[model samples]
Target: MPLLNNENKIPCYIQNQLIHDKDIKSIVFVNSHLPADETLLVKSITLVKRITTVSVVNNFTKELNLNSVDISHIFIFLDNINDIPSASSAIANQEVFSLNNPKYYFLFIKPTDNSRDEIKNILDQVWKCHELWKYVLVFCMETEWLRIVSYNPFKQLLVEFQSDCNNTTMFSNMLKNVNGYRIKTIFFYTLKSSKMENGKCRGNDCEVMETFFNYINATNEEVVLNVTEDLLYPVSQDYIKQDRADVMFNNMFLYIELYKYSAFAFAHSNVYAVVPRASTLTFLTNIIFMFTPIVWIGIGIIPLIYYHLLSIFDNYAIGKHHVRGILISKYVYALIFTCIFQSMIITTLTSPKYRKNIETLHDLFESNLSIYGVKDWMYMFHREVAIRYKPWNNTSITSALNNLTLDGAYIVGEYWLNLFLKNKTRIGGTYNDYYYKIKEAVGTGLLTYYTRRNSPYREIIYKITLLRNMAGLDKEFGYREINFTKALKSKSLTLIHLQSSFVFLSVGWILSTLVFSIEVITNIILQHIKTK
Candidate 1:
């Protein structure tokens, strides 16, 4: 596509810089009617460079279809600065530019529109649509000496340079050399030693902040949050902003997911619940559960097999009548026991007859259990059932934590779920004895953090998050898998499986009875002799 004319050839240096990042597969050139000279330049660049490009002509006549276009880097050539506002508004509605990333933009302004006020005006017009002019480079040349400017993520720092070499080397150098930018992060405390949690932060927050500052190199500005849900929560975006915090531990733990922050996803969170252990069934129910009907029916078939065996043994064993009877009885007993044992083992191991707890979304809503969790956690994940139950107060929270409220299930993140188990065990001296997470997850929970917009440390934090997530954020962030793990085959072991133990116990009883008889007979004989 002939975009620019032959008279004005694009510098090779710019072409090399534009294709620097290997991540960018295709470049989008959005321009309107070009002059004869510029059109020839575009033709030469397009053919010689061999860089993949998507040409979208904006003649101000009709809407362009950018829906299919996967635009990463944008080359916008603007002749008139006044046309920028309308162009920005039009592009903002399109999916290609909806995110307002501010990066991936290289503005080629005409010399006439290159002024301090014009640049400020252009920024003002786009301000409502965009947050910060991050990674944006604007350039206009007057003969050989090049005039270029770069803006950082905050958009507060304006770096202008007049150099012969028009490359992005300055931008890279500026990013590293930039200093005096501090980040103040306010995080919610998971556990509080004092009754009142508001005054100062302690416990888990201290440990978390230590690891946080190590990666981010930021100071902690502690903020305590108390919600009606009575569950521990991270700080709100607005609250942290009001407190003048440069960064924050937002969208973490149980906070409602906000999509406003720049894309730096760190965690895969799900709405897991602390459900009552389903093994706590009644005696009658337990007895019924023990008989997990195997493929070959244990009860009915075993008796018939024993009968057949007894008949076979009677005929097969060649001995005296009493001896044959004893041998047949013993053989029948052993055969019947073995058949029952095999069936029960297979049945119980394959499918343990279980008392159904809340395992699915349908099961959860239908269940009578009062769900206790963060308000947003309940509302977002289980709105149907969440409406039925009220948020837990402090009193209810204490009781629920101690396994006092058996009917109530607490919804929590997999990370916090482990913490809950640890806390319970610390107090009660039991690990997973009282509560267990259900098989079905309510929702996926993300362990993402939202920094105060335009915070300098935001980029560093994002990079750290990327590395941590790639290495498994769940384990990297100290989430214990042992807490949530359940062994189905072994855990499903029930009372009826102990029948063999009872058989041995019965044999011990018979032996003890024989010993008692021998002792009594010996004592009686001794007494009779003494009397005589």
Candidate 2:
């Protein structure tokens, strides 16, 4: 038996019996005396015996890799009362080595070190591993009676800081109480990327982000937020000027002095960041059907006009009873019908597929109209749009709007673009070119919130986002376009449709006038000859 003291009063059999009763798999003896060939009666259990000194105990983690090895039981035998303080300090520092990870711990100490201060210090180190003592079995070996006490680590939380926070004013404003978990704030603003670490980002602040960050650092919080690391990706190169300046001028007197000089002049104008909304502009199928009526009306009018003209000719000159007149009229009617059908068929075959107008991304690509994007950035996030438009960065959307170039198409969010287009009366266009959308939306990124690996508040935030999305808040936020139920009315004719009508009128008038003039000239000549 490893002697608890010089007397060695505790029997090896009793210790083995207690250990066997508990069914402990592995045991680690620290600063305990045992023979080189010592074996416990329980052959199934594994034993690691170490007679470590104070110096070795302090640097014990170096000798043993706790992550790779498993020790179910830990027996720390305090040799001297003075060694108690050093051992406690060593255990506290190296708590990661054998603390909450073990399934069971058997700590054998002398009854003399059971004073209030000594016991408190020893237990304090044990609790550092988070909610200890559930698996711990403490025994104070006394001469007459053994003193055993059970401690529960979770009964009272030791104030080793309840929460953590990064020093930012926005974070302070956003996270409210976080389900009653007190945040122990430490100002250290760090980021994995130039990613926006917030769910609801507005300019320079984010309420969702602050709340999430605070909730993440809290000790008792166990919520898992379904969020990505990068909530918003600013395509601009100079997004992190604030974070960068903070890092560079962190200890600089001159930088602080310069900030004082320039802060008021810029004010908050340049401090906030704005991300453009992402969504596809879909083609309105309803609008395309609106033009169907006009096409039918135009085709239907051809036969009607032909019959009306034949009736007019019969009333003016040729009687229906005359065989020549009847044959001529039949020939003319056949020719007219043939001409109309041929023209309709040829035009339909030659022209490209019918699109209501330039509305969808596919329509934009197919149209002869040039695509205009931002001058500073390429709006190539969506692959198909990027490939077709190939985004011209030389001219901006603002400039394009200002110019109101009739030959080009501009890509922008629906709400703002619609508003702009509604007010754009200066541009002389008969078509409502403003209300257009791409049918397939390019899903490049999503706006999401992040939490710590295990946070209790995660599910709450997730549900909030789901409800917001379901309510179509994206439309409210201008990420989605207005749902236009009404289709385009093609009753309003364009130049192409009127061209055929004008040609028929022009030819009829010209031919009638020429025939009348020829008849009048012949009559005058005959009368002149008779007078001569």
Candidate 3:
């Protein structure tokens, strides 16, 4: 028998420690990294578990034969399989266990703090053999453990762990004594003020730990807090409330500044909880009032003077022949009237102030306006109206109009407005007409165009009007009642014919107006010469 030498510091237990148990169910092989001898050791241990082991291969599988044994579990140990032959051969051996119907778990062991490039290379190999079941890669460094858990085909897997020592204690004790806390403590201690300077507690080293402990104690309720390396110092619950209050204050100030100038804001602040709606006409009128001084200076004064001068010149040349008379006749009257009419039309059509007053019928469909129209119209154009259209063939235009009147549908500019009003009384007439009621609602600003709240083209309208005024186009023309009537009839005919009626009507109106004016002028001149 060999004598045990106690003087040489060799004990029976120390000698036995070097020997690994062959019957061990789970084996943890410790080494600086996987070596050739270690691979043999792993293979021998796996053989006892009745699993075949194959060497890494470059091109072909080098199969190892083992007596058929019942394998229930398998754990693959690997570092980096840089050698293609060894890796391929090892995977080929793992395939045998699969045929043996063993439940397998592959464990890839790597030294921790791997760079992104190294991690990518490792993942490339792992993904290639992902068909194998139950795989886990563990990166072990003294400071941190990077674990890549399994992901199924359809779902993504995310692993979140708490960084706080107190919160993490419930899961794993290993994290509680991590090196992060030691590094943080060391950093705080090295601060310049961390050392006392006049018997006063100096630096941030005062009661940070105590305060943190208190915070942990306060959170008695179960709450999952996700931690990263950056979140080493946990925030206190009291500080979170202060942060929320600060955010609220900032938002309130921002909104208040936004609403400071307009009547909309004034009403919201002082008059009522919400602003009232107004008719298109009334809304535009108020907008004109808001910028009254500018209007008076820009177009009102100069246009009035110009119109008066033109009228004086036309009166002086009233007796001229047809061509000269046509050129000079009614020049002043036309100019003045044109100035006023054009001003109104331009303001109404292009101004941002007026846009809010009258929205397109489509706008009503899209808004919260309780309108009803045909389903086809709703499908095609109701998005612009902001209204809901209900399809009902049995519903007549008269009945629909009546319902709208009763419900006080403020604005009804739909395609069927004329058809709906054909049999209804005028606004002031009997039958409690819906159109009048709607008009009243609009006047009171109860139901108005949704677009009126914010003028989408306000700036563009202002710019265009400014341009028109600068170009001296601010003039109005009086409505020619007889000619307008004829024109209206011709326009109606064009609508009925749906052909080139507009061109025919335009030519006819111009010819008719010239002939009528010439006849009148010739008769007046003959009468004057006969009297003389």
Best by TM-score: 1
Judged by lDDT relative to the true structure, which candidate is superior, 2 or 3? 2
Q: Write the per-residue lDDT of candidate 1 for residues 1-532, one digit (tens) a residue.
A: 2333222323443455454544444455557345554555455446534356645455434555554344555556556556566655555444444333324444454444557656665665454343334444444565654566665432344566765433556435233533433445555544331122466444433433455566533344455455533434333556543434544554464243444443355655566766665543442355455444552264456456545644644553332343344344445556656676666544443332232443465555545566776555654464575676556654466556664455666776666566666664545655377676666677665555565443344566666555544663455444423233333332333336545644543453344344444555666787799999
Residue 126, model 3, lDDT: 40
The runs of at least 3 residues in candidate 2 whose Cα sits more than 4 Å from the true structure, single-residue gaps closed, are 1-356, 359-362, 374-384, 393-395, 423-463, 467-532
User: Local distance difference test, per candidate?
Assistant: 0.50, 0.36, 0.31
| Superior by TM-score: candidate 1 or candidate 2 | 1
Q: Which residue ranges in model 3 land beyond 4 Å of their true spot?
A: 1-61, 81-95, 101-130, 144-148, 156-532
Encode model 2's per-residue lDDT on 139-176: one tens digit a residue.
Answer: 44534444444333333332121111111111011123
Task: Name the lDDT value of residue 502 in candidate 1.
Answer: 40
True-vs-predicted CA distance for residue 501, candidate 1, Å? 15
Using lDDT as the measure, the top candidate is 1
Q: How well does candidate 1 match the true structure in TM-score terms?
A: 0.51
Worst 10 residues of 2 by lDDT: 266-275
- TM-score of decoy 3: 0.19
